[model samples]
Target: MKRLLVTGSNGLLGQKITDLLVQGQFPNFEYIASSRGADRFDAKAYHYLDLDITHHAQVLKAIETYSPDIIINTAAMANVDACEREPAKSYEVNVAAVANLIKICEDRNIHLIHLSTDFVFDGEEGPYEEDDRPNPVNIYGEHKMAAENLLQQAACPWSIVRTILVYGVLRDLSRSNIVLWAKNALENGQPIRVVNDQWRMPTLAEDLAKACLVVAERNATGIYHISGKDMFSICEIVEAVIEHYRLDASFICKEASEALNQDAKRPKRTGFILDKAYEKLDYVPHSFGEGLKLIDEQLAKLQSS
Candidate 1:
């Protein structure tokens, strides 16, 4: 709680967490955000440690150097299709890299706040709870689920937070994120073909960062389901974006098949059941409309910039 380290500091969630920490909004005692790259930030308040989790020596070196009480591991090979194609790399980074980090943290008795995904559960029984069985349908989910199991079996203190359909963020220079893709596609007048059948709770990145910090502050352990307020289809999100910008609604249409070189099989519904979060973490996510409005507001700012 006092001294902390957050991996994947350049990622969507990582960046938001850094922003919150810099603004003194995060409840952590003291924080140091780590990333694989030397991405510069104006966070004059907090410390930054640039280290790649994929490298064992670097991971151990950072842990030794920082000597943090808590390590939040958000670094992962999260690209679904890419993971499907490169299963070995996915296992290496998402599973093996995390195992290495956990081993290092265990040696020091440091708590780990590991982020997971809703994809771990196949769409069969959606609105999944923390105790529900995970039967991953894709390689990405498979790797993440394996990592979760590793954390659970380990002797160290760990908390695994599983989330879904994360979005929001504008100028993130990272490669594996979804928000800028939607904005860029829309701005270019490209027809956004979204899957109407797929359902999920798309949590905004800002909200997600706050929720994570809340869990960290309360020293909450075990699995927690975190996401947006309401369920929505891909097409629904596209329509919301179109309406937000007052663009041609026809530009956002539903595709019959969501499959297009999709190496990883996606679930029709990966939305989370967040009653535990509400009760335990006191998490209050924004409604679907509210979430969409926030995205549109951010998009408007991006347009003006």
Candidate 2:
């Protein structure tokens, strides 16, 4: 079996990828899950490595030790506001670390599957195609765009999978996603403000993991827009979350993006058009409602466990 290495193994996307490889009955590949610290999950079927991708030496050491056929880099400084607060830190994790991985993968002739975001666009015109021009409006987007540029120059095989508004749960991770955030706030009768102007495809983490697997399995190169099929405003997403869980919708306050007083600028309408992914990888995404149901099932399992 070919060995596949995953960075950021503790993250939402990384955890989903691990779950799929270990539990989804995909038998063709063995996995090595790496993160900044010790393994957080209870699963013991795969190898876990303490990898800090921000450090060049650590990245090199991990790659050398694993000798993976493919590397799926799900590690990123994803918080937009945090990225703005610390631009240097953002570049370190998002851009510089990616450069390190690209160089290593190129030298070793390993296929690199990198994750990107829809924020690369300014959000003026959305549902972007693969060939659309990128004009990032924030530091986070700028860093991710820079990483994409680095991938474009890589000598080894590379695939950049750009997704939006990913949501799901992990057993030990404390990270909060949109679906869980909405459900928790509404269930607790807490009023929350949601942006009505901004639009996204709201990808399910599992769907994105599957998309990454498709790219890996096919050794597909170039950028692919992998995201949910349903498009909705941030407000509509929360409304749907409330509807699905049978929670009161009156607690939701619909507001425009400008009124949110967020430190980072957000795109108004930046969803992906997945035509290229469909054609190249045969990638299909779950609808938002279907994603919520999956979240419910996963949450139930977590609770019972």
- Winning candidate number (lDDT): 2
Candidate 1 accuracy as lDDT: 0.81
| Tens digits of per-residue lDDT for model 1, 102-141 | 8987888888889999999988878888999999989999
Any runs in candidate 1 off by more than 4 Å, and if so which?
Answer: 172-180, 299-305
User: Could you tell me the lDDT of residue 110 within candidate 1?
Assistant: 87
Clash number for every model?
0, 0
The digit string of per-residue lDDT tens for model 2 on 1-305 reads 88899999899999888888988556788889998888876499999998899989988988898899999999989999999999999999999999989999999999999999999999999989987999999999999999999999999999999999899888874679898888888889999999898989898999999889888888898999999998898888888888888999999898888898998999889998888888898887888888888888888898898
The residue pairs found clashing in candidate 2 are: none
On a 0 to 1 TM-score scale, where does candidate 1 land against the true structure? 0.93
What residue pairs are clashing in model 1?
A: none
Q: Give TM-scores for every candidate, taking all chains together and pairing residue i with residue i.
A: 0.93, 0.97
Residue 170 shift from truth in candidate 2, angstroms: 1.4
